[model samples]
Target: MAELESPRVMSKLISFLSSLLQRVAESNDLNRRLQPQKISVFHGLTRPTISIENYLDRILKYANCSPSCFIVSYIYLDRFTQRQPALPINSFNVHRLLITSVMVAAKFMDDMYYNNAYYAKVGGISTAEMNFLEVDFLFGLGFHLNVTPTTFHTYCSYLQREMLMQPPTINSAESSLCMGKSSKLHLCFNDDESSHQQQQQQQLAV
Candidate 1:
């Protein structure tokens, strides 16, 4: 787990997310271009005006959550989208979703976490709205927040692979590959009956 929280891992995650947001932004542009005749009415909602990189940086600075919290938040985002297909991660709702997921993951995975009011301040929303988003996001995820270590590492490995598949711009390709290899080795090392039993005990305790 410590390996997942390392600076290298965090940097790669940030880069991967930046790339993802860029792709989303580009896709939105393409859609708008292709559908120029039709008024793009996204459930009567406007896309978020803030830049994704800036919003992510704000969360990284003020959320004060562990790196693992962000990783777990990514996992929750995946689950949320899978469970709630109508609420896809696009420009319109990605910012709110990101903030809500991070807040929920911090609360579930960390012993110490800020309340909704504090998260609202960090996320630039009102406390009441934050509360609403929290409740809605929890239901969207079906309240499933228990992430086993194996699942955690598996997500990390996927992110690493994604980073590797992208073109190397900042010399992250080698590091991402190394991280993927390391996570696979770690998974193998932890694949034992004792570790499985321990995880079950931890789940029950949760």
Candidate 2:
């Protein structure tokens, strides 16, 4: 794995990821107003007061995982959404989703990481809930946790395009969070798929 990113780069990465997730959650929330979706264990009875940016920043500040873990976590999220189409990410569930995905990513990709109890405290949930979330998320994703080098590069390129399209501005009034036009994330992880096909899917509707 690559060395950890510098603080500045990591901060920028966090800001970019936070903005992207916030946009996804907000979009899903708007959609849910029209058609209610099935709620799962990931959903909270009420949305947490903490802003998405602050919550993600807190995770990065304390988790101490490699930068690659962030990318991997996002991959896990996309996979989960694909497998569980009824559970599109929304404001009520995104926070728990973020914490669980990051924790699982750290466990898979990092040599050393804090246990579930510590992550539970950081995420403002009980240790038992955190453990349950980890298991449910893995099953939701069918335990397909290994990210090949090609798949990793594909996601990195997609994020690079996103950063270029929308510069890393956290919450500027002038900034708009218009994501890519497609409604589906075209991340083809099948080994049989060609790189060119995956590159085309890099538009990344999410």
Candidate 3:
């Protein structure tokens, strides 16, 4: 935790995350192009001009959530892809996905965060689209917003290992070959506030 507070370590962390996501999105896009897939709500009519690295850096700049949110956002993205196999991350929708994941992660993990309007502006989308994406993403994850300490550590370890293997540059080509795409997250919601609070507290403790 102390090391993570250092500016240099934080920069490196962001670099590793952006690099990993960029590579994964590029690989998925290539695979998606080879076999055209059905368009989902996440897809845009045209791919955004911004690069994933720049988009992420912009989020880090404007969204003042803790650095840990980035890791949680990555987890959310992985879960989203696993659940919504038809809507894999690609250049066409990666920017929106990144913003949604980060914003959702901030809401789940942080004590305070920007509202949909602010996040929408930060994401280069409208408030209505941001709201729509939030609901869709939460529903897609089945509102399974909790992350256990073990799971968190596992992801952190994975990122650290990848960082060691690849250069600390967001433009690196090396990354996980493919994101897993087998199972679907159960898409059900229960109005259980106690359970939700417990999950949030557990994640906060971690």
Clashes of each: 0, 0, 0
User: Which lDDT tens digits does candidate 3 get at residues 1-206?
Assistant: 33666678778888776776666667666777465566766789998888777888889989888888887888788777667777767777788888999989998888877788888888999989999999999998888788766567766776676667865332222222232232121212222233346213222210
Q: List the lowest-lDDT window of 10 residues for candidate 1.
A: 197-206
- TM-score of every candidate: 0.70, 0.81, 0.80
Tens-digit per-residue lDDT, 149-177, candidate 1: 87788767766776778732322111111
Error of 2 at 115 (Å): 0.7
Q: Write down the lDDT of every candidate, Cα atoms only.
A: 0.63, 0.75, 0.71
- The numbered model that scores best in TM-score is 2
Q: Which residue pairs collide, candidate 3?
A: none
Candidate 2 structure quality by residue, lDDT tens digits, 57-118: 99988777778889889888878877877787889999999999998888877766778888
- Sort by TM-score, best first: what order? 2, 3, 1
Query: By the lDDT metric, which is better: model 1 or model 2?
Result: 2
Which residue runs does candidate 3 get wrong by more than 4 Å?
167-206
- Residue 186 Cα positional deviation in candidate 1, in Å, after optimal superposition: 23
Report the Cα RMSD per candidate.
8.9, 8.7, 7.0
State residue 102's C-alpha deviation in candidate 2, in Å. Answer: 0.5
TM-score of 3: 0.80
